[model samples]
Target: MTGWRIRDYHADDVDGILRLWEQMLAVNADPVYGLSDVLASCAKDHAVVAVVGDEVVGAAIGRAAHAQGWVVFLATAAHVNGTSIGSSMLAALESRMAAVGISKLSALMPAAAQARVGAFLQQGFALKQDLHYFERHIPVQREELKILAELGGRVLPRGLWDGVGGMNAEKDLLERRVVMPLAQSELADRFGVVPPRAIVLFGPPGTGKTTFAKAIASRLEWSFVEVFPSRLASHPGGLAGALRESFTRISELEHAVVFIDEVEEIASHRQGEPPSPTQGVTNELLKIIPAFREQPGRLLVCATNFIRALDAAFLRHGRFDYVIPIGLPDEQARWAIWERYIPDAAVDIDVRLLVEMTEGFSPADIEYAARKASQSALENAVSSGAEDPEGPFIEDYVAAISATRATVSAEVAKEFREDIETVGRL
Candidate 1:
């Protein structure tokens, strides 16, 4: 006869439950329910323990709903191997939960827990085949919502990452360098890859630097907070003190992606005479970055139209992991951008021609041209009093493209390529 006898779990048996949980992990029999859940069941739900005198060596925890009972946890101490203690505990746990009028008892365990399957079956449990488990964890918690609202941060919509049309090169680069490391941090760590804490996105104006920053935050499902230099300057502490306070509050969040667009305005090169008024702000930012890097699961993306104008020390090795270039869109990217702005109902618009014509246009320029074309078409159709006013025609778009001035001039584009070679770090 077995020396161990099954009984209802008591507060004194808590130490024994913890010991068994450790052994279960050692054997790769991963529990579906976490330790906290098992502990709660022992206190408020159904639990049974197998004890030899006052020392417990086995435990089974279960919880019941309207008609279903689930084995939350089950395990026998390593010292009591090749015995029926596990099966006995399961039987006792099931009996205790039966008061809830459960029609059936079930269990969810990792595939690694097969070593204990025999014990479960011995207790009249049947195994199911061809089953799988899927889980998704939301990044933010309810309690964090208040902190986020106060910080003027938000959780961007799910599709923003995918919705960012065109700029394939920039997208692919950020995905590998920033998103992959942060999203798959554990996997990255296995290969000795330190997840990036900060990065710089530099290019000419209207090249979609800010869009990429928001997309990175969206892809990671982290809070996105854009720090406006102009807005911070109006704070009572001035730009420097306000910047410090902003980051201090940001530390309260579990994970965040902080963006500072036009960072050059605050981090510009310190120059000449009695020093620029912005130099102190730049010095404060330099001090803030190291502290920011110490925290995991945070990324600071700073974008600048003029990389040359940024202070040298601001983009140093330890401060930012990568300084990537987001340049003008290519033909394929232009085609994709054009497709985004085109109306679904618009017929025979000859988009390929429009794409060909807007060779030097930016995303902002494309959006402007697309909207202008629709407005002009609507005005013409109204003025002529047509029976059915169709969507904007190719001729309307062509005129719009001709009228719209590209944001990046040839001189600016040339300087951007030069900055890419000299200033780009990726």
Candidate 2:
């Protein structure tokens, strides 16, 4: 029991299961077992097994075909009961099914295996009131499926957008200005609305501007590929040429939401005497935007903490479709952020009090305070060796909140307000 672990099924497990089944037979335990069936199940579907001391003790098999999934096999040695190995194997199988977009899973088992159904039930698998399993086997080319994975340059999980707790106005604006057009291109075109190609996200540092850019890509289900000026400066033809070459590669993808955070590194104002080193790169980026816009399924989202520092031409109407501001979270947004990071076990905690105390805090600042409180709570629990550890108390949160510093200083907030009044397009 000390060394037992549940893991993916290996090819050698076939013989091990056969041996286990033989041993069970001597004890008058009978199971509908066959070598060919087990072999085929392992080869064609998601299969996992429990192993203890160099022997396979249990197995669970599942297959996901499009949106429908099936649990075809489940077995565990009688000797391993109460070890929790059966439940773990079922969980692994369910996880694999969900990963591939399978929404529903059903199982059909022999009467002899009915005792093992408890494991599946414990893990949230429900008994279908009236259902039957049927199949129509079809040969598929596995290589063709690889093309789906290859199309996206850097596919981001859709869950990231959901985790971005606060900043509702910014999220709603991006959804309207960017996601709507791309997600409903056909409908947008019918309404004589052109899908947006480029937009600039401007705000003070640590305001979740970069997070919003990635969230937009996640919301659209498009690949996210960020272009870093620091890395591009090391390329052969210098930053300008590197910028050109990077977009050329990006253009190959069918759907992409490209990001350029801290874009001011290259797109800053071209000044005086001899001209800045960034001037040439800024020019190259200007030239790339029109060509990038010509492509139907692409969006170029640039983020800059210093909106005022960007070259005048770079943010002009023809160049960027919109210039949006992602300022500090409003009161409602702050409440959402607090709810997200606050631990559930902190029962009867005054969320409204926490929210009120967190005024003038950026999303990053609020997150920091929440984390610090959590860390303090964890440290207290560890030191006390308490079995049921308490969560961050109100006083603990106030202390953490007092210690944390806001990323957006007063001067920066004032500057951002000026930019919103003067430069913001939305």
Candidate 3:
């Protein structure tokens, strides 16, 4: 058995801690705060370390100010894995903070650090739900950004920006319906039941499936992993490798959200047709699902445009636990969608008329209309050489509204609604 001891940070242990921090950053690529900064912060008596036979096995450094505490660094030596030393060190730190009348604590961690973050949460840290750290490096020259853009990678825009729109409702639903229930249910203690059940969100394209996935991940404080189906099938038996990697990475994440957009291409069930040699992909994925279920803090979400085309096997219990039908927005949801996209421009616009006209419109359709309107207004202003122009005029919105027809025709919507009703009755 490995022995463990917790002690104050010491000058002698600086080198070992530095090595541990370097190893952590190497594996995670998190920006370094430098050894001098860490030492200066530790001098305030907020640093603690776990030593296993003269080697620093685990450590946590934090600072307290104005009754709030922040955890700046936490790491465990890679060689001393699975000792629960990291968890113990966190507990000790929490206890120490409590002694000083500090109860609230926060930390910034990479998405890959889910397991370690989970250890902290288990020790009674209340996660701040919203707020994610998204960073992209800036090249030395603007030309580099242009080159990156040409290669189809996005260059970070100057300054930090939150994604457009709000997630309050989504956050509330995730916390109340998913996170809190899972936390209090029997799943809380049973690793086999703790991992989020595989769920399928199927609906019209651009209906916010991807956004909903990210919001859920954020609300639950789960690391989100987005997988591209095209890359999953690049090799012979490559699908298996890809699926395994996704599950393995999520397992390591310890409360991760694995979202597969356009999932029908991968997990779709095949029946009555000749077996595909690539059938190994489905088999491999099926096997991994159970393994993920056995691990705590893993969530697998699949979104698709066609639900009926999917294999019945995938819909069976223990595979995809829920098949959520994300249909086109209802009248109320359409109004909300319009309000979200055209916040300022909607001041004088008849939102009720817009919603009524867009009876069959999906969330994506509404957003598209708003954006098209905005673009049209910008172009008109530039062409006219106006002294001043407002963003997205009502007339422009009306013009954009007239340009496109509803994606979900009335006949199609009726058929879908009836089919769902029939299924629910069954």
List TM-score per model, in order: 0.70, 0.71, 0.59
In model 2, the worst 10-residue window by lDDT is 132-141
Clashes of each: 0, 0, 2
lDDT for each residue of candidate 1 in 1-426, tens digit (9 for 90 to 100): 357788998998899999988988988776788999999988998988888888888888888777677888888877785337777677666655655556577887788876567777665566777532221233565556677888889877555789899788889989998999999999999999999999999988888999999999888879898898898888998999999999999998899999999999999999987877699999999999999999998999999998988999998899999999988898888999999988876768887898899888888899899999988888988988889878678888999999999999999999989988897888
Clashing pairs in 1: none
Candidate 3 deviant stretches above 4 angstroms: 1-176, 183-196, 272-274, 343-347, 422-426
Local distance difference test values of all predictions, in order: 0.84, 0.77, 0.63
Candidate 2's TM-score: 0.71
Write model 2 residue lDDT over 307-354, tens digit each, in one string: 888999999898789999999888899999999998877757788888
Using TM-score, give the best candidate's number. Answer: 2
**Model 3, range 1-426, lDDT digits (tens) per residue?**
367788878878888777877887787746345667677777776888988788887788877765566677778877764336666676566546644645366666666665576556544455554432211111112332333233222222211112424334443544554556455557555644443466777666666778777766654544457777687667455777867865654454435567888877876776545768456666776787777667655667788776666666666777765566556776767776788778564437777777777777777778788889888877887988879755666777788888867787777676556645532111
Model 3 lDDT vs. the true structure? 0.63
Better-scoring candidate (lDDT), 1 or 3: 1
* Candidate 3 residue-wise lDDT at 406: 74
